[model samples]
Target: MSANAEDKLVIMNEEELKRKQREKLKKLQATGGNPRPARTLFLFNLKNPFRKACTSIVEWKTFKIIILLTIFANCIALAVFLPMPEEDSNNTNINLESLEYIFLIIFTLECFLKIVAYGLVFHEGAYLRNCWNILDFVIVFMGLFTFALDTINKIAGVPPPAPAVAARVTSQPDPAVRRKRRPIPLIPSVREADSEV
Candidate 1:
């Protein structure tokens, strides 16, 4: 084809692609999806310096990796804490509760950053619009709620509740009593063997 014809063909293709995208977006919106436009709508003024900074920070790959690693570390800490004996947990130099609080603070900060970068729930591409984001939002609030309760308890001089495992263990029969119970024999007893003979 001639150069002019090629140029016209390319232009037509570009227009066709744009049309397809528009149609797809319309279908998505019709089905209750929040299809965001090329130009995003921010909760606050787009020109605000803090919001702009937050948007950049939230979009950075390193920031996402750091959050993922923090989650992994928190999971490892929980795993270590769960199987530990209640007695050993108290004597350990590393306080798992304090580690949990630190993890919660990091997650809460990440949540706030995303909220500033993307609008909370009103705008398209808002923080709470995605299902995963909604889960994170609920978890952060739950952490804050627990933190508040812990603080109140400390101020009121109320003791923390015992763990269910600790309570169950405490209620079990004494070790000596448990040891006295005879095991059921899989083989015939000597008296049974003599009678058989």
Candidate 2:
């Protein structure tokens, strides 16, 4: 756009805007304003349930650390569950699955904290606006999916095989089972049996 058109669009001329701001700052300083107030700890108040928490750089760092720890918890649970053998995974896997649920719960809570902290819409950078926040939200949903699958497995008494694995392959009975319940033959030689024992 031409400078003439842009100039027309501006509601306040730059000089006038600057002058107004200076006057406002002067008034604030007259009332003992420090221009920049010292940062304070964010005390959560239960009365104002929707109020955002610590907005300063330092408090944001603390929130980031909490997020990182939750990620680490997710990684640990995944490490425990993913490589486990199917035979052993059924019974023992429940424990790791429970651990994942704990992480999932924490992630859900973090999402809530972010919502209450930043708000759902624009203020500066909104919670859902940033890509990292979106990623975090996605991870939380994926964790929920895993928890649901685990719950279903617990209810069914068996985990479903992967789609790539045919049902028939895993459905086959154990190889050790024999049709005949053959009687054990007595040892032919007592001395050899004693030596083997």
TM-score of candidate 2 against the unseen true structure? 0.48
lDDT of 1 by residue, 1-197 (tens): 69999999999999999999999888678635634322234344565677778888999999999999998998888777744445345633368878888999999999998887787877667888899999988999999999999999999999887686578778997777776785545788899999999
> For every model shown, what is its TM-score relative to the native structure?
0.62, 0.48
* Residue-level lDDT for 120 in candidate 2: 46
Runs of candidate 2 with Cα error greater than 4 angstroms are 1-47, 53-63, 80-87, 90-92, 121-123, 146-197
Candidate 1 clash total?
Answer: 0
Candidate 2 structure quality by residue, lDDT tens digits, 1-197? 69878787674577789899999798657535633222212433323434423234214776779778878877776776754443445755787766766777877887766655554444344567788888988888887887788779989899666643454456754455433354456766988888889
Error of 2 at 169 (Å): 3.4
What overall lDDT goes with each candidate model? 0.80, 0.63
- Count clashing residue pairs per candidate: 0, 0
Candidate 2: the clashing residue pairs are: none
